[model samples]
Target: MNALYHCISKYHSIPSGAWDALCKTLTKVEIPRNSFLVKEGMVCNNLYFLEKGCLRGYYNLDGKEVTYWFGFEDNFVTSFYSFISRKPSVENIQALEDSALWSISFEALNQLFDAHKDLERLVRIINEQYYIRLEERFMAMQFKTARERYEQLIENSPHILHRISLGQTASYLGISQETLSRIRSQG
Candidate 1:
């Protein structure tokens, strides 16, 4: 798919043969809204690349679902700790809408990575990107006002407000729904 090609190209130049080989391992899947891709306590064996729709990763905290991140079209979503370590995940990955995705099992991906060093490079770059985004989010929560954080969220993912539920958005922004409502009204 073009999304896969674009992602690889953005991270590093891959040989055509290697790209094709990697693509072959990916399988297309269609998931319904509200379906769980990775449930808490289950090992996440697959890395999913969104072809359409959206997904959210959340953790249950004090009987509340606190969203950590969202993935939209052309983005990748996975319980990285679970996938890499082959351990149970603490987060739940759920579809926000009916979605299509390309997924490859962790075993298959590791095999491909072993066969192609360039794939390892691409994976490292992607991991670093994820880390940077998480760091930015942490800093925003610590230092930025709620309104500023909301504004930055809009700048980073313009369609997020439209696509995800307000409850999830509030969780992601680490605000109460009422607070998010006030921020939205004041904006």
Candidate 2:
């Protein structure tokens, strides 16, 4: 609940009444580690606000898990394309640790946004932030050297190295585990 308030407050000025109303509509749930929140080929019905622990979004590429991104506490996780289009998703969202999350179904979220213009604005800002992060990641993969990427990852999320498994970290960096190990050793 505090996480939602913090996010909304950070993105837009929300009236107290609207904030309370939105909070009332949210459903809080605890998910076990390694459980799928959104599986490939399923429509992503909920927008999750992570309050504790971590989650990852990944896709299968040539029988290998290629991680796209990770979401930690106070972050939002969703299959944006599938959620917005109301179609089946190609990526899978899994809890990396036992997590506490507040979520709302697509229908409920739409109703809230319709009822509160500020909420809609907040959603737009969040989407923009997501897009910017995605663009940065794309550029890093395209233009940055492997060591540079690893350094940037460490700089941006120092805890990731300790929190996530080496294999998962390698996948997220678009590198093989052996290469990641070499990068780590050379540093």
Candidate 3:
């Protein structure tokens, strides 16, 4: 809960009453390794704050899963497009380890947001942060080599190498396992 509080406060301040109300909507969950929080073609109605463990978000392309993002403790993960559009998600978010999460449904969150303008502003700021991250990722992919991307990812999330398989790490970096191994050796 403190993690969530800090994450929100990083962007904007919320009234104490609104924060308390938002906390009431959250439900803590334990998810086992290899389980999906959201599967392809299913609507992602909940947003999750990962309190412990790791998760990966991937797209299924021609029967192969291509990893794009990873989430660890103190981070949030959701199929944002699916949640916002009320449509089936195209990607899968799965637990990479046994995980602890606090989740709130879209309906619950929207209701809270409606009742608290300050909370809505906080959420807007949060969305802007995510958008900025997306843009940075796009720019990195456009201009950075695979090794450079790997280095940047490590600099950003140093624990990732310990939490993921070489294949998963390689996929996330859009490189092969051999390439990742080579990069790892060099680093």
Candidate 4:
């Protein structure tokens, strides 16, 4: 919880009353390994602050799961488009390990936004950060070779290789296990 508070404070500081109100709306949730926090075609009604463990967000492409991103402790997780638009999500968010989270419903968060302008600014900044990362990923996918992508991933997020399976890492890097193996062996 303190980590969550610190994360929020780093974005923007809200009034104590608004913080209390926001805290009151948060609910604790526990998800076991390999379980889903959200699934395709479901409306994501809550935003989660991960307290422990790891999660992955992915889309199913012709029966294959293509991982887009991962979230670990002290980070907020949500199906952003679905949460904001109240539409069904095309992606799934799954727990990689036994995870604990603090969740706030869409309605509760919106209410907080209405009541606290600072909270809204904080969310906007967070969304901007999300978009920046998304663009970086898009550029990497567009311009970089598979080997370069793998190298960039290893350089930027080496912890991912340690925390997830090689198969999952390969999926995230937009490569197959064999290709990843070949590249790793070349190093």
Candidate 5:
């Protein structure tokens, strides 16, 4: 509710009327710990607002789960390529804890975008922000030292150490649990 409104307002100046209409279309869902919000090979039809709890995006590779992104409270969580392309998701978005989420269907969002220019602009901004963050993560993995990547992750998500498991955090940083342990000890 308020979190959704705040997220939208952070990017654009939307009218109360638009928020009222948007609220009418949004559904609140509770996901349990260790459950998948958007499963791999399933089409992601809705975009999620992470009102509470945490979600990690991961995919299987070489029989192992590789975590790539973690969405925390107030962040948007969705398999964007799947959501936009209307294809099955390659990654799984999993709840790390009991979570409260607000979801809007693809059709409902399109309708809102058609009716509200502000909301449309907000969506564009959201896409651009996601792209920029993704680029940073990719460059870090390809070029930055492991320690630098770990430091950047800590700077980007200050509460991540408290909220996330070390193994998952290590995977996101493209490092091993032993490496993470060494890094933690060095700190």
Candidate 6:
């Protein structure tokens, strides 16, 4: 939980008492590699703080998995729409490695928001960051060529290549596995 505390403090400093209260609500969970934290058509009832390892959010489109985002250690992970709207999610969140996570249920989180206003501000800031990243990915897919996208991924997240399969990376870049192989060969 130290990692979670440190990450949260970077965004907003919660009073010690509020922090304790928040800690009490957290449930530690372990997800094995290739296991799902949330699956399509399920309501995401908990928001997770990844303590260790990796996870990816993807959509199953006509039987193909299209990964859009990856979450690393010290990051928050959730199906934002389903978590907030109380609706079933259209995407899935799967652990890419054996992972340790701390989760807080939506009900407990709301109670904390009502009690600790600062926590609410912290969540708002986190949401804004997520939106900014989403916009950047959207723009890149709209304007960048496959090679350019692969280069940008190498520049921004080279470690991802070591952590995930090349096929998954290719999916995230919206390119064919063969195209990614060709790009790698050119290097």
Ranking by lDDT: 6, 4, 5, 2, 1, 3
Q: Please list all clashing residue pairs in model 6, or write none if there are none.
A: none
TM-scores of the candidates are: 0.96, 0.97, 0.95, 0.97, 0.97, 0.97
User: 170, model 2: CA deviation in Å?
Assistant: 0.5
lDDT of 3 by residue, 1-187 (tens): 7888887787888889998998999999999999999999999999898998899999988887899889888787899999999999999999999999999999999999889999889778878888898899889888999989998988998788888898988988888999988988996
Instruction: Report every candidate's CA lDDT.
Output: 0.91, 0.91, 0.90, 0.92, 0.92, 0.95
Clashing pairs in 2: none
| Model 4 C-alpha lDDT versus the unseen true structure | 0.92
| Better lDDT candidate (2, 3) | 2
| Model 3 TM-score on a 0 to 1 scale | 0.95
Instruction: Give stretches of model 3 more than 4 Å off.
Output: none
Highest lDDT: give the candidate number.
Answer: 6
- What's the CA error at residue 143 for candidate 6, in Å? 1.0
lDDT string for model 1 (49-136, tens) is 8988899999999999999999988787899999989999999999999999999999898899999988878888888988888899
**Better candidate by lDDT, 3 or 6:** 6
RMSD of each: 1.1, 0.9, 1.2, 1.0, 0.9, 0.9
Reference-based lDDT, residue 175, model 5 = 93
Model 6 RMSD in Å is 0.9
Where does the lowest 10-residue lDDT sum fall in candidate 3? 122-131
Shift in Å, residue 77, candidate 5:
1.0
What is candidate 2's CA lDDT for residue 129? Answer: 92
